[model samples]
Target: MMRNKIIEMRGIVKSYYLGTPNELEILHGIDLDVYEGEFLSIIGASGSGKSTLMNILGALDRPTKGHYYLDHLPMENVRDDGLSQIRNKKIGFVFQTFNLIPRSTALKNVALPMLYGGVPRSERSRRAAELLQLVEMSGRSHHRPNELSGGQKQRVAIARAMANNPAIILADEPTGALDTHTGRLVMDIFHRLHQEQGKTIILITHNAELAEETERTIRLRDGSIVDNRMNGHYQLEACNESV
Candidate 1:
């Protein structure tokens, strides 16, 4: 039997400042599907719609046209509360900036999401500790954001993102702030999560090399998907021939 799709987007169109003369469409009729355990990367240059598409997929923004289904629930018809529930329960996000509270300890930062979900204090601490260990940050659990290195801070952010055991993890330029070796370490963690934990990961990056590490790569240009390939394989000859 085929694995169910975790995310489905059909003819997704998004525009900023709709109806005004300055209105500009960012995503144009995007059609994409992500399977339950797939690791996918979306790559594009600056001004491409990769970030816009990521925002829509993560439900941080809604499409002006088209449909989005997350775990079989239609998002277009949901109210704000329903959307928020889905976001909290089904999806997690990591950003390049790490986004951890400067004054909070790593454990506290990771525990905040569970607190929002109303988990008990003991259970929250247990889960947060487990996730921190998963990211190899158990020793630094008491460190504040400022006390950690850039890579360590991002690891803490990743641990926080996984605190709720979300089905999908959305990462935007997750390694942008790290040095080359540290960036590879972060990617190794992501790879292990997909391989061992069966998590669905969608990463957005401007680096072509990073995109090649995923199982699938979607290339966007000027707000459109110029190329999308599976198994992280694309032929220069084929692209040249198409052009």
Candidate 2:
């Protein structure tokens, strides 16, 4: 069963430089809540602090001032080692860059996270193959990053993201590198993940059009939320199951 809220943020304030006069505050006292199994998108132009907020959400960074909770666990002020464990176990990240190992096969890339989590080699490989199949990449499991097209690499990356069965998937411009058609394909996979698997997906994008595909959209401007509302595209059944 899913929790009432998978993520919650209160009084989030992020800044560069601790106490000096040159400190640049990127996020200003923001409050947000995301329910379990929801598809959410955060949209903003460059310099709007969207990326900074994503970093904090993914446990890559902590707020300069604020409180954040993931699965009801406080995220602020955690030690580096603790943060790393939480990131690996609780969150999955997909980036526009398709950060796959150039020399690793698609199956190996998908299996990497499980490897880090200390799953047995045989079991990791078995689970990796299953995840690759989930993303419709089973036929290309042997291909390396250099051998695949941008979309194919991204599919592999998506499979890799799902390897650990994380509580949330945080995508940073996931479709930004693909062409329009390919981008739609990637988005379709995300939708299937959300609707069929009930994944809690947090997509970060500057494209308003892409953001509209999600159930809820949050627009940020100048370090503050300008809009937070539900889109008509939300499907009630999407949050009902986990595959």
Candidate 3:
């Protein structure tokens, strides 16, 4: 079956201190395509440009030289404000740190993106409640970040990421801070979302075992793709088990 392409990046080059002796290039040149409703993982060691690639993929940063089409929109043509709008509308980010507002309840945190997107007050609350329930966080909807366990906080963060019903769920080491068991629970949520909701997911992680759980894995080394492998029923018991 032919699938729609959700993300396409070509000749992506990221460099710092352009036109100077101190210039340093992170990503050499990357070409990537992510299909709609596909769960893909990018795995690499630290300093291997995983973070750099992710920033570009998430539309948080632009490549110095390259083209990126997100949902078929040419990203290089978007202005700063337009990029912000695109991020809010098309890209959902779930980070390792669970970047929640300490002062806000889980429901409020999940509703924040909607508030910024100009969703009506009543509508935002209704949707936020629904998202929390989706992530199994409805019971903790009234709790603050400090009051929730790490796993619960991460779940709430995941719920928040789904607030805008983005075209892509970009998860950056979503389970990095949790225990193996808790992380498994979080990973299960991602699998469920993919299988049930047909969500397009891109997971940036270093754990090869975790990457295997995805439909495909792309390995990066020294700022270049080293391997692109379709994972066929890899064992799940070893996924970050020793972390």
* TM-score per candidate: 0.93, 0.94, 0.94
Residue-level lDDT of model 2, residues 1-243, one tens digit each, is: 655899999999998986788898999998999999889999999999999999999999989998999999998679999998888888999999999999899999999989888899999999999999998999999988999999999999988989889999999999999999999999999999999999999999999999988999999999999999887735445444443
Pick by TM-score: which candidate is best?
3
Number of the candidate with higher TM-score, 1 or 3:
3
Q: What is the overall TM-score of model 2 with all chains considered together?
A: 0.94
Poorest lDDT segment (10 consecutive residues) of candidate 2:
234-243
C-alpha-based local distance difference test score of model 1: 0.90
Global lDDT of each model? 0.90, 0.92, 0.93
Write the residue-wise lDDT of candidate 1 on 99-149 in tens digits.
Answer: 999989999999988998889999999999999999999999998999999
Superior candidate under TM-score, 2 versus 3: 3
Candidate 3 residue pairs in backbone clash: none
Best-to-worst ranking by lDDT: 3, 2, 1
Against the true structure, candidate 3 reaches a TM-score of 0.94
Number of the top-ranking candidate, with lDDT as the measure: 3
Displacement of residue 106 (Cα, Å) in model 3 is 0.3
